[model samples]
Target: MALKPATNPDVEAATIELTIDGRAITAKDGVSLYDVVSGTGKIVPAMCYHYTFDPFGSCGMCLVMVEGKKAPVRSCTAKATAGMVVRTEGDDLFQARKKAVEKHLSVHPLDCPVCDADGHCELQDMAFLHQVTNLANAKQKLIPEDTRSLVLDFNMNRCIACGECINICKDVLMIDALQFAKKGGFTQVVAKGDQPLACEFCGDCLAVCPVGAITNKYSKYRYKPWQLKKTTTTCNYCGDGCQMIVETKDREVVRVTSPLSWKNKWGDRSETAKG
Candidate 1:
């Protein structure tokens, strides 16, 4: 069987040849350079990127060395060009990406012990993978948590300001319920007008948050990622057949989550608003 194209199947895009890590590869032209690199089975850590929406280069962890560029460029926002030579690995690239992760960690709170997204967090995984051991100047945000939402809680202290939630909400789902606001001397994601979250409560924001900034109110501090078993099934609420993950603890239903998450980042979720 032929492998499916990495880009959208609806439109026809020109094929382009690119070299990654000294290996030649062909990918869809005009697509994200990160997507092309990821298609080759190489995992480049990226916190602010998801296949569901356009690239939002907030995290800056997806840096790659291009032939002509003097410095490593963010691959997620860079478009794939023909006959381009790219390098995905090096001590310089690793240190560059590590510095990007350190910036987010500098202002992030150390609440992983009781955080709901502790085990399943992208930030946690990236920190461990990148060997982020010492942070002599790690400052805490200390912002108060926002629990006004009916189903979700916003903890600004733990937020990395990745904008994954805001991008997914605005670009893919079209809800545009969340936005970035300067509050308490920090940039934070908040509901529109800086008020309580009032939207479809689809939980896509919670799913895309790289850190423990946004969490489910229903299952907060109740279960860890290891304790829950996830079951992917069809959503019965609508006819669109949007897939969802049902979390269960000891055979008891805990929470219903959509597949549009940060870890399992693939596919187009534009039609998920109807779900």
Candidate 2:
């Protein structure tokens, strides 16, 4: 069906065409690379790139090799340009992804066996996907639990310091308890609480967290990823309806992502891509 239509009609409406995985795609000039990727069926995963907050590329998870561009740039924030070639998964991407996984898993507690989000966690799915499709990664990368949330483990060892949790906590949720400190390998996520993290309990942080560093206590040991049956749909969380595909692995809501859009790159006019 046609995307519910662009809510507000007053929205520069720039235009451009770019190459994604080799196919020429046209889209609004200002639309983010994430919009283009999501518009297509390729389904590049993104944990922290939310439409509500300012686009922060700290997650480094959405990195896509841009043709003619030296380094892979973030699809979430980068503006799509004409004649641009976008490459998603590849050997170089695999290596980069593994390191990202290793970085997050390094400090993340080995709690999937006990964690509530085990079955539907995006991080777990990502790890499982890479391991199953590619050669498995180092088993010793697992880390121990650093902090506890009554039942959940808030391990810093698994954090990539994507700052997604922090940004969500600060900007979207306004709890501002979590923050990233230091630089380089020393960087770590911490709560400002004199007690525990002053979390608002939105759980968006848990949902957006790329690894198990942040977790849920209630769902621990309850479900498995493959056990859940996923269905593509929309987000009722708000009015824009934001066209999303919801995952229902175990007859419950799991996650959401962008839906097809005419304004989006892939959904753009077929004639435009060839232009």
Candidate 3:
């Protein structure tokens, strides 16, 4: 039997071609340059560029050089266009990303050794990629940690204001539990009504957090990222059967996470399982 033609019109459309660092790449139109570049094995460093939520471009770590533009553009927000010329890596781009990383480290405490996200943290990976040996020499700002939440720990000192947690909590989850308060240097994430966090203990915010600012309070200091052996499985708690990544260390299951992907809408664990 002859197979029926693909029903999706978008699948048959011509792909957009773009150049990155002198290498040509083809991608579907309307997708961000960050997606295209990352799909081609050139991962752009970003703190607030989660695949589940809209790209906020709050962090400048994914800056890239675009033809005809004097200043570097954020790859996460820059759309892929036919014949577009992009430079993902160069001296200028490197310097810009380096400065961005340095600024984030200025107020961040050096708690990676003890932090739960030690090996898998994005900031730590970026620092290593850029060979950033020195933390910002500026006076570190000390903010009191908030531990009122029963499931997650909030450390203001470690937050870079990337807005991933706030965006996910408010926009994606439709839960107005978290928001950015204050201005300039005083701005920080706070629960709505200034009360103890009261919302779905989904832990989605903790999953998207780039830094250790928000972490699992129950599993805090239990095990390092490298110590765990990840096993992908399906949750059988309900009929939805959501996919889960179980982390085990020394034969003990330490933590569970719903792996995020383009196929997973809003990174909703329950919904993903249903699909």
On TM-score, the leading prediction is 1
What ranking of all candidate models by lDDT puts the best one first?
1, 3, 2
**Model 2 C-alpha lDDT per residue in residues 101-135, reported as the tens digit of each score:** 55555445556675555555556776775563333
lDDT per model vs. reference: 0.82, 0.58, 0.74
- Least well predicted 10-residue stretch by lDDT in candidate 1: 266-275
- List residue ranges in candidate 1 displaced over 4 A: 1-11, 267-275
TM-score for each predicted model, relative to the true structure: 0.91, 0.62, 0.82
Ranking of all predicted structures according to TM-score, beginning with the best and ending with the worst? 1, 3, 2
> So what's the TM-score on candidate 2?
0.62
Q: Which digits, one per residue and each the tens of the lDDT, describe model 3 over residues 1-275?
A: 12111111234445667788898777766666677776667667787776555678888998998999999999887777789899888788898999998888877888888998787788888888887877639455677778898777788888888888887777666786898887347678888866679888767777777787887777889888778898999878778666788889888888887565212322222211110
What's the number of clashes in each of the models? 0, 14, 1
Model 1 local distance difference test score: 0.82
Which residue pairs show backbone clashes in model 3? 242-273
Per-candidate Cα RMSD to the true structure, in Å, reads: 4.8, 7.3, 6.5
* Candidate 3 steric clashes: 1
Candidate 1, RMSD to the unseen true structure: 4.8
lDDT of 3: 0.74
